[model samples]
Target: MAGKRKTKASKAKQDDLAKPSKWRLQHGAFSGPIRAADPETGTPVQHRRAVDTLGMMLASGSITAQMHEAGEIFRGLFRAACFDSMSTSQLLRIPGSRVDTLSTMQIEARRRVAAALDLLGGHESPCGSCAWFVVGLEFSVREWSMRQGWAGRTVHGPVGQGILVGTLGTLAMHFGLTPRAKAA
Candidate 1:
């Protein structure tokens, strides 16, 4: 009976091993091999130099953002690259952008709404270019808010107003979304 059981177990193991492997091979997941001659140049492509150049390109904002989703994606990836799980807000906070004592949900919802709008219309360009545009506007608004000396209750109100006004100005210039300026 023991021998019979041993035989049955061996048969089961054999059947398991004989069954077709469950793993399917995935494709195109690696960097390709180096060719002898460079097409662009009439010289052989130096693999090490090419790799170093590639790393620099990834470090750059425009190419990186173009390859990735956008500044937001880059920010997340940057946070993750640190090998820590801390939230992004905890990583970097622009001055005057922080609310002293707000709920996490409220803060996150605001950020999400802004991120959604930013991602809309396929605006996934690099921060290197767009930084000047977005941060310039943000800076102007912050200055305006400071000048206005917005009170406790109206702090959000002034910032909202500034953003709305700035966005309208941008749209007016770019898309003629609002009435075009008349020639003098």
Candidate 2:
């Protein structure tokens, strides 16, 4: 009878182990609460699903796909920033409007990327040369992706390059490939 009771207790323990834990069922893998606002802007986050999806793609190693998707995201942001009444014809008629718009976006992207790299804790060059280096690295990646048959295009090629530079640079910094900037 004692041996039988021990077997029964072991079986009960096995059953408990087979059942998924409550936390696992609730959060699956990620456990932290999602942020409601952008850390920089303090505004309610927009395109939450798209941003999360991009993160998932990056984790999954779908680089080229994410690159194309990033272009689409930039285009969406550009459109969102435009006046609601602005039409495609009106936008096209402005002299250098497209170039100006794309340049603005690229500059903004580069700035944001640089800020992100700083947040990742690394020694970056004070002359802002590291950001440009990141831009070149990102541009090379874009060109390579194009060669590999990525079809999407941004209005200004540098827009995607700037974003890529910031991202890859941050990764490099995180891995200690890029040294942290020294205090003056």
Candidate 3:
């Protein structure tokens, strides 16, 4: 009886060992077991250099400056777009037009700047909502310009507002606006 009990206990222990670990059970279906990368092994030279460069840019506040510039460009576009009578040249000539245009520009600029900072800090991904808003705004501006004979006409009054808005929006995303994830 004692020998039988010992054999059963040993068998149970062996069976437990044969099963996959809890971590493996959770993450192994799609990929193999997760293992930490060895730091001593080191990443490839090119990858290491790229990482270093990005780190330096972040540390030196270059990315933040770039992001600010991008936002400023967008804000300029927004100011330029809101004018009901000013020609494109006139709008271009003026710097920091009165803060009386659509409130959307202000909100979007803030969002873009915040998103860029978040991306640089690795706190969040790029913002898709902001990108989409800009895209829609660009389309509307282009259509409005066309209707007003600003673009798609013999005398091109000014650079298309659509182009400016689209460019600014794209720059914002490139600097670090998080994109939305597709549903699985």
How many clashes show up per model? 0, 5, 5
* Model 3 Cα lDDT, one tens digit per residue, 1-184: 4564444445433335534556755632322334455678865322111122223333556444444455555445444444223433343445777534557765675565445434434222223223223332332333444444323452122444333333444565564452323100
Model 2 lDDT tens row, 1-184: 4564444445433334434456656633442444478889899753323133234445667444434343334334334434222344454476554633545665565555445445544323311332233232222344433432223532234444444545544444443444556210
- Candidate no. 2 TM-score: 0.20
Best by lDDT: 2
Residue 178 local lDDT, model 3: 23
Q: Against the true structure, what is each candidate's TM-score?
A: 0.19, 0.20, 0.18
Model 3 TM-score, all chains together: 0.18
Compared with the true structure, model 1 gives a TM-score of 0.19
Report lDDT per candidate.
Answer: 0.36, 0.41, 0.40
Candidate 1 segments exceeding 4 Å error: 1-8, 11-102, 118-184
